[model samples]
Target chain A: MIEFLQYHLPVLLIAIPLIAAPLAVLLSNRYIVQSLALAVCWTTFGLAIWMVAIVNQSGPVSYELGGWAPPYGIEYRVDQLNSFVMMFVSGLGAMVLTYSPYSLKAEIPLSQHYLFYPMYLLCMTGLMGMCVTGDLFNVFVFLEISSLSTYALISLGRTRRAPLAAFQYLIMGTIGATFLLIGIGLLYQMTGTLNMADIAEQLEAQRLVNDGQWAGSRTMLVAFAFLTVGLCIKMAVFPLHTWLPNAYAYAPSVVTAFVAATATKVSVYAFIRVVFGIFTPQFAFELLPLDTALWSFSLVGIFLASIAAIFQQDVKRRLAYSSIAQIGYMLLGISMADVDGLSAGIVHMFNHALIKGGLFMVVGCFVLRLGSVQMDDWKGAGRTMPWTSFAWVLGGLGLIGVPVTCGFISKWLLLTSAIHNELYPVAILMLISSLLAVVYVWQIVEVLYFEEPSEKAKHATEVPPLMLLTTYTVVGANIVFGVWTTYSAGLATKAAKALLEGGSL
Target chain B: MFVSIFILTLLVVTAITIARIGDLWAAVMFTGIFSFLGACWMLILDAPDVAFTEAAVGAGVSTFLMLGTLALAGKTEKPTTSSSVVPLFVVAVTGAALIYGTLDMPHFGDPNSPVQTRIEPSFMEKSQSDMHGLPNVVTALLASYRGYDTLGETAVIFTAGIAVILILRRSNDGFKSNDVFNSQSNSRKGSQ
Candidate 1:
């Protein structure tokens, strides 16, 4: 059993959700289907944790599908980087699934309840599978899988605008996917292999022979360009973030929490893995002004998205725009292009997921009780639904990088990295963005806790126990990860070490 | 090169026509024509697999979905309610930038290009050792060397199916009225 698991654990982590996804629609009883999906999520979550443990003990773990060898077969790679992402992805999956039933019961139509389970499970399969795969083109395939399911899942929102939002996402997502395909096709043509490790070695070797001219081919440059743009768009970086707010604001609150936490983070991982992993930082940064481009785009995203977030009256929309700004922080770390910076970025990915996931879940609780999430509807409701409101404030602090919350840890790491590099402006900008966060968060706080309780909010009570429990669990985790930085930061350091060393494989 | 250029010219012309035409139905049909022409261009570039996908997905699935949408929403082009200059400017800038970026690329299909000399030939040799010989090598690559990608593709298609069900399933009324759908489609075309 140990030997079998050692070989198949990576594939099993992906396949479990996939196998369960199809089975989700078979049950007529929605309860059974939800239970099955929840079970699948928890199982995958367990597998991800175990997989991370195994990877830690034994360097990188690689599984070749159908006994095929590397450079020739499909490879599932679980290294420090991916294992870290895997734990967050599947862990977030389980947490979101745990919280979903309560939100789903209140929000989604009954006829669509069974439909939701299948799509949710399939989306989980797509995200997990995307992170686990090692092949470059394979990432594109899994991106599509996750993206398609996400579009459908978002369209299942109760509002008429849901389908329109889903359609908008589909258009943008397909364009991104096509760009990815074009980029991968170009890379395959240039390097003659799809396996990431093989491509890296070949490119590295060719650079040595041709004094780097071969690696500097315009085709190579274009390939990198397409891949970067495609992925940045998928990551919702700066100008490419138009599709995000609507999709998040209008989707079912359960979906908003899940996709908000997992989707863009996975896309960011893909960008890091593809651009920084296969392209190798030496070639990417030297041959191109990639860092300058990243810094500019990310800086703009931080200020612009944050300012936008503050203007939104709808609480979910506010959080949605805030997500774009948080993503900018992650990108700022990428722009630093060193081990310390990378570690900061990866830690933020994990911690931000917890923060945003919990915050959105809090929004879910509000929508569940108040029937809408506008700021006016939440007035003085905090006094009535004290527990849920308190959890929201906790999550809001994490978003603001408050002390003793996970958000603070990542922001501090990012700040130090920025100042270490003497990018004083960047450091100041990060501070400004964090302050922007405080303003928006405070605005919501005042409405919820300070203002007169509206008549609509007069009857509001705390959300159901299960929902509140899950939200508080994530909120507590934000603080725990913040205060006890040893675990999350340690994994992030391991991942950063692996990524910046041109990969262990 | 001449044949490919001829096909390219036709494609460009078709695209221009599709854009200029105000009749939505005609534009949709022209889009199918453009897709077919694109598949032909892909064939000229010696990428039959990509051509197949473009034809099936672009011409087949997309056209069908557009028709379904037309059945629900009026197909006639609304009056130009939005400004065109900003969009046009954006396209111009982007197109110019793309053209500039291409200036450094290797000429098309240069035999000694890095593409031919790089990692793929070696990867092919490595794959030759597997039981599956390179009979229709793209298939081998897709099925064996990249089996997980194929699995992902299956998931993508499955997700799309689910999306269709989610968006369309809730409204049972739309499916029952073929006459209304057809009349709506016809009126839209008539207005155009």
Candidate 2:
């Protein structure tokens, strides 16, 4: 069994969830289906952990689908970078699925419960597929799998705006997917391969053949631009973030928590893979002005979106805006284009997933008991539901980059990386942006604790223990990973070094 | 070449008509026509398999689904009050960028192109041996060499089917007259 798992874990990690999705629908018993979905999620999470261990023990693991060699077949490649990402994605999927049943009771309709489990599992499968697949077109295929299911999951929201939000997301997501396909097609035209490693090797050979003029090819540049923009939209990076706020705010709370944490993070991972793995940092940063452009957009996006978060009245919407700003931090780290900076960015993906996933689950608790996500309705919630409220405080502190939290570790690494690169001004700007996080986080903290209890808050009690336990589990991970930098930051640095070593294979 | 040009022209015309038509029923029909024209162009380009799939899936099935939607919903589209300048500019810029990118591409059916030179030769020989002498290489490739992608494609269709069911299925499929649902839907209605 051990020998079997060593070779097949990568494919099994994706296949388990993909197969369970349709199986969930077939079962059609809400209770049994939910249990099955939960089991599948945890099982995939276990497989991801095992895969990570195998990768750490070995170097990188590549599995040929149906025994065909790569560049001619779909390959599932798990390296330090993606295996790390896969672990968090499946980890959060398991956590959220655990928290989902009780919270989903109040938000999603009972009749739709069975359908919701299938979509959730499919979305998880798609996300993991995107992480593991070595083929560029395979990325697009899994992107659609995740995206289509996400739209369906969002439309299952209780509010009337859910369908509208889902429709808007569907439009923007389709455009992004189309742009990505066009970019991949253009690259295939240039390199004649869809496998990322082969494409990278082909590009390197072409550069040599052209005496380093290959990077200047208009087709290559156009493909790079399209892939970056398409990924930016999917990542909800600032100006292109119109679809995200409404989608996160209006979706069922569990969906919000899961999608908010994983979807954009996976897109960011994809962007990194394209830029570093396929395009090479030297080509992206030196041959072009991509680094400068990325940092400028990321800096402006951070300040703008962080300020926007302060003005949002709905708690979920505020968190959504905060998510955009947090993404800017990740982008900023990427722009630095060094081991420290890249690892900081990668570590933040893990940290922010835990922080934001925990915070959203807290919001779901409020939505469950208080029946409103409005800040006014949540006044004095801290006193009535102390545990859940304290969970928010922990998550909020992590968001604010307070000491003894995972958020601080990423910020510290980012700060040092900036200063190391003689980017003092950028460092200061990052600090100022952290202050903006404080302002938005404080606004909620004040409402929850300081203000007089609303009628709803007064009547509301703590959520069920299962939901609260899952919330704390995620929130507590923020602290645990915060203190223990070995797994989060250490693994991220290894992944970053591997990525920068070229081709990420 | 003349027949391909005529089909391409009709494809462009149908696409514009689908975009400009006020009535969605007509728009749907025009979309079907556009897809059919596109498929014809593909066939003229010697890709009958692709043409057949596009015609059956894009023109036939999607148009039927759109008509079903129109029957259930309304047929007319709402006129936009917002300015079209921004969207028009965005579309023009994207189209220009795509054209600029295409300018560097090898001419149609250029044998020296990387796509033709690098992999196509090997695929022909590989299919005969690896695919057990399958007559059609496309089928062999789709079913064997890149079969995982086909599985993913099937999963995409599955996801879409489930999405349609999730969104359009009757709300009261199960849990008839449960007080939990009653109160929840009532609150939802009140919130709306």
The most accurate candidate by lDDT is: 2
* Candidate 2 per-residue lDDT over residues A357-436, each given as its tens digit: 99999998888888788888889988899999999999999999998999999999999999999999999999998999
How good is the docking of model 1, by CAPRI class? acceptable
Q: What is the TM-score of each candidate against the true structure?
A: 0.92, 0.97
**What is the per-residue lDDT of model 1 for residues B59-78, given as tens digits with 9 covering 90 to 100?**
99899888877787767887
Which regions of candidate 2 fall more than 4 Å away from where they truly are? B172-192
List model 1 lDDT by residue over A171-263, tens digit each: 988888888887887777766677888888877887788876665466677777888888888889889898999899888899999999999
Off by over 4 Å in 1: A212-214, B44-57, B79-81, B92-107, B110-135, B171-192
**Residue A181's C-alpha lDDT in candidate 2?**
95
